[model samples]
Target: MLSLTRLNRVRSMDAVNDTMIVEAGDTLLQAREQARAEGRVFPLQIGSQGSCQIGGNPSTNAGGTTVVRYGNMRDLVLGVEVVLPDGDVWDGLRALRKDNTGYDLKHLFIGGEGTLGIVTAAVLKLFPKPRSVTTAFLGFRSPDSALAFFTLLRQRVGQDVAAFELISSTALDLVLAHLATARSPLSLRAPWYVLVELASSRTPEDLENDFHEVMQEGLEDGSILDAAVAAAEAHAMAFWRIREEISDAQTRAGGSVRCDISVPLSKIPAFIEEACASVLKIAPDSRMVIYGHVGDGNVHFNPLRPVFESAADYLQRTSTAITTSVDAIAMAMNGSISAEHGVGVAKRDELLHVKSRVELEMAWRLKQAFDPKNLMNPGKFLPRLECVEALKS
Candidate 1:
């Protein structure tokens, strides 16, 4: 791990081509800063940017809030240099925007979660940083209204919409109770809220005006119950802090059984409604902390233990059932059980249960081809398929 960390370096920066060559060990924050220095941007913004390494970002195909605009780590990476399990280095770091040479090998390891090999460095794609920005906290009667507001905002603003995050009232209460700096920006509280941002290379006045016009229409149409637009950069940061501090706030409440899942944007409200009902039926005392990137259909459905119940007892009784119920809803909606989080040991069995036989066989073959000896990050992403064969025998 020490050797891997030592690989941090910005090998090259071509501002003309809007590309940067950075080692995998460099923190995501480091990569963003380097791009900013060149008057460009690497727009993978996540709460863990300060400590999470670039290599791991691509390995997990991390999708942050900015994914609504800039896309995930997999889409941002142009090329990568990887070390095979047998210590052979495959240096395929090319910065060209159009390279259809062969099988697009870099993708094999992007979301592979280090199972195939070790990613040492990468050629990252960059974009022109947005000069003007505006953020707003909008209150909605429910997730369905929130989704409607999201669609309306996108239709009006188009690609300028940077982040569209959904926050439940439960999530907001947690932030206010636990986080000292947190405060409710809106005067009237609704059951749901959306933290939205608009950005462009144009002037701030233009962006602000456009945001105000759209919001006013939403208010008139009853899609928006109330709204608080950031008057300054500090105010925007405050609104964002509410979204960013959710995990910490949940931790402060008590440990939670969290499920990172995604479904069609249209099915979000139905999935939440059904899943919440299912969970309460199994554990009536469980508190559901629902939130996530609503624009992209990924939600973090977390069920916290009741204050009166012992943590060990609650988990032992309800953890598996709650997660299974939530995931089953997502799968039924043609969504994913593991969205951006990736399938580590925690979800290995869940993946096996969800994936088709052909998909599992293909994954097993890829594992065998890349790490034949089973030495690279073994028993993590892919489960032992031989067990299924043995059972049949």
Candidate 2:
């Protein structure tokens, strides 16, 4: 395996241009810390930031909770240096914000998942560091309530609203039971919860008053059951910990059928309700550990096996059924079955089921043009010819 782990380096930092050129092997945390050292923020904040390499971020086009405001790896990247198949180096390491050149070829490799070429280094856009930041946790009786508050929030604060994450009570139950320190931020027991954060470098003053006004109105108008503004940085981190530990708690509680999906914002509430029903119709006892960046409509609708169920039986009989059911519902809503996670080997075959024949043709042609020798990371991301042929025909 070709491992570029040793290539970890921050090649250059252009504070004036608000861009940083980082090596492929540099961890996301490394990039962020370097940017922070310059008093700028590299906003791709994922749970795996400590280890997830910057190259893979663009290869898969990773999106985290911050996607609501700053966008995904694709949006943050300006240009990339790729090692092409024929031993050619495509030196596209430019830091131009508005390079209206030919076809904008940098995008070809951004979400290509390493199938096109190896991204050695990239010019990543940076943002002005937030002068003021506020974090709050709110509870809702239903998904609708949470969604409505998100709308109200955006209207009130605009781009200042950085993150609006939705967590289900079932997901929280897993966290509280698994993590010894985990505790609910709000006293009220609500089925749905949101961990919202606001930050702005432009705002000279603290954002508390502006944030509270919106929260107060949501509570008064019956949009939110309970809301708590984090009293300190520690409190804010504690609230964030609950949202971040979901996958871990689910794993500790015995793994789940992971369905990463994204629908339009307006359809999130109905999509969740319908997806839950679809999953229950098959595995009635599966615990729905549902949560996501609902502001962007990316739902991690994972269903855990029942406590008493055997893992073997569940894997053999229940797993595919659960995944298929939920995935089908997501596609029905005109949403993607794969959101933050790209179409790796896990979802390679599933790509045929979702992608059209024309789209598949374009991808195949591009793959052939880039790596005719089948030299790069192959046997992943897309299906074989025999598989796509049936769909194409």
Candidate 3:
């Protein structure tokens, strides 16, 4: 594997264009720091930001917590310098906001999962750093109520709503049980929770006031069961920690089968209801640990093994059934099975089944055009035609 860690560097920061040129090997954390130093912000805020490289972000089209406001990696990236399969460098790094060129070739590699080419560097768009941020953790009676609260929040706050996440009660319970420092911000327990964050260039008082108003209204209207507003930055971080640490907590709790899926915003409640029911029908004793970026309609629907069952036994028995059932429901609801997570070896078969024949054909054609030898990141995202044929035989 070619290591680009040595290529890590922030080439330039042009405040006038609100753009920065960063080498692909630079970690997301480094990019964020450079942007901060330049009085700007790189809004791709993922849990693995500390170690995840910038090149991989666009290659996978990563959608982090701030995706609702800033969009995924494709939206944040303006241009990329890719090393083609032929060993030629394509330097298309232009920071212009408008380029009415013949074809926007940069997109061919962004979200391409490295099959098209190797991205060595990129021109990334930046935004003004939010001067103030307000966070609120609200307990809801159900996912329906949480959805209602989200709609109300967006209607009231509009673009100020930076992140709106959904958390299941079981997911929170696991966090509290596993993590030493984990604590529920709300006094009362409910079936579901929504972590609401508002960030803007406005004053702190303005942001806080908006949060209080919307949260109070949600509570009065019965959409919210109970709520906790962060009084300080520490408080906000604590609330976010519960959401961020769920995956780690799940690992500590037991064996987990995770589904990264997304449906229409209107279908979230129904999708969750049906998915949970389907999983329980297969594994009665399984614990459903569900949570995700609800604002962007992606949910990490994970099922944990029963306390009595061993990890190996549980995975062997329930893994395929659980994933298939959830993925089927998501497809029936016109949602995607892969969502933000890229289709690696694990999801290759699932991708083939879920994606249309036309879509798959086009993807294969593009892959052949870019890397005819199939030498670039082979057997990663798209399955090889020969492998599929061999499996059939």
- Sort by TM-score, best first: what order? 2, 1, 3
- Model 2 Cα lDDT, one tens digit per residue, 273-326: 998998888888888899999989999998888888976676677788888887
Error of 1 at 247 (Å): 0.5
Tens digit per residue, CA lDDT, model 3, 1-393: 878998998898999899999998899999999999989999999899999999899999999898888899999999999999999999999998799978999999988889999999999999998899888898999899898888887888789889999999999999999888888998899999989899988899887887788888887888789988888889999998998999889888768998999999999999999999999999999998999999999999999999899988999999999999999999999999988988888998776678766677778889889899999989888766754444443
Tell me how many residue pairs clash in candidate 2: 0
- How many pairs in model 1 have backbone atoms within 3 A of each other, for residues 3 or more apart or on separate chains, i.e. clashes? 0
| Model 1: per-residue Cα lDDT over 32-107, one tens digit each | 9999999998999988999999889889999989888888888899999999998899998999889887899999
Error of 3 at 389 (Å): 7.9
lDDT of 1: 0.89
Cα displacement (Å) at residue 115, model 3:
0.7
TM-score of each: 0.97, 0.98, 0.97
lDDT scores in order: 0.89, 0.89, 0.90
- Candidate 2 runs further than 4 Å off: 202-206
Model 3 RMSD in Å is 1.7
